[model samples]
Target: MSLKVDKASMAFTFKGGMLPMTVMELTSADPERIRDQLAGKLNQSPAFFQHTPVVLSVEKLDEPHLSLERICAVCRAHKLLPVAVRGGAEPVKQSAWALGLGWFPPADGARSRTLEEVPTSDMPEESPAAAAPQAEAGAGRIYRGTVRSGQQVSAPEGDLVIIGAVNAGAEVLAAGSVHVYGALRGRALAGIHGDTRAGIFCRELRAELLSVAGNYKRLEDIDPQLLGTSVQVILSDAQLGITALD
Candidate 1:
């Protein structure tokens, strides 16, 4: 007879998930040049690079040779962890394995779609990260229905206007701003592309998480007085400010 198994007692299980990861597209193969550019970016937005996991994308590089290790080192010095390499030749793939980094096919090599664009019957492996949803004819995207738990809506190009409540475990992200007509009980990330002037406005402020321009405040990190009130979250000089709408 087959033995009964308790799945909950299993020490490990593999599950698929969609996580946000930053892609560092490379145009040049010179490590020094990359270092110089990273230094400038660090100076402009220091918090944006704080131990962020990034994949080095070499699909656009025209050079025949790449100093992959040196580039990874430079990224580490700036607090950017190089977790993987995307799109490279056989030697490049071998080098990545030597460095213990995962390999991804070139963007053009694979016909992948963002999480929102994929249908249930036909889903492809996710790309490095979903390119934030673009604006339609220079205007933001609007959602008319409730965002149920575990669902995500993104308007990475402009503002995201939600006509209904964002349920617990839901998420909303935008490159410009996020405006919720109903209660915002889940997580909201505004200015995810580093737009410092972006803000988050909600009818009810019992959010599990709030972020602007990479600065985030969890529920515990928020002030007690701000809970259950209408509020706007703003980012100024890399600081997050949550103020009442009243």
Candidate 2:
């Protein structure tokens, strides 16, 4: 007879926390009005709105007017998923629960405002009379956690932030800027689409390789003195430079 070995223990491994979901602030008084606005924006840039998941913030909406079913239906019509509801009145919270949507309270010290009260300048500017709209720089998201070896994080639409160590054999890729709050000993590639303006920030820079867009700097290319120091890497005038963080 053969003895049984505990092979299950060897096959299981624990990882860090779950990835955070993106939250979008609705900040609109009339759900129909906001829907129209979003539709118009998407019509102008269909590619930008496609496949982008978002949650709604209804703090700006009054308590008795809007219902959760109506909001979810509107979101579905726009191809946006309403995974969580935020910033609404008590009735709004109840409506969200009725519609099977998670209700998340606003963070502490966060200010609440009405749609009419909020300045519309924060919204993207629209063009008129055959004039073209200006292209805006893409926004980036930051993650504050350790990336273990054999782990990977990728951001295709925007930049990514990591506030933890990137252990050996781990990889991080972003289409925009990449900032690591801790050590970076793994591989990181930024500006994956030739943005060139993308950069890397780390407290301890000892990576095997670093790249921005198509340009790269290998470990052998950097000076030994620059290793293991807090630094910011940028591409200036087609050359990569490491500078001390202020």
Candidate maximizing lDDT: 1
- TM-score of model number 2: 0.43
Backbone clashes under 3 angstroms, per model:
0, 2
> What TM-score fits each model?
0.56, 0.43
After TM-score superposition, the amount by which residue 225's alpha carbon in candidate 2 deviates from its true location, in angstroms, is: 1.2
- Name every residue pair that clashes in candidate 2: 59-87, 143-161
Candidate 2: C-alpha lDDT: 0.66
Best by TM-score: 1
Candidate 2 on 111-199: residue-level lDDT in tens? 33322232444322332311222222346665545565445566766878775677765667787878887888877777777778988
Q: Write the per-residue lDDT of candidate 1 for residues 8-45, one digit (tens) a residue.
A: 88998789985556667788888999999999766544
Candidate 2 Cα deviation (angstroms), residue 109: 42
Q: What lDDT does candidate 1 reach at residue 134?
A: 27
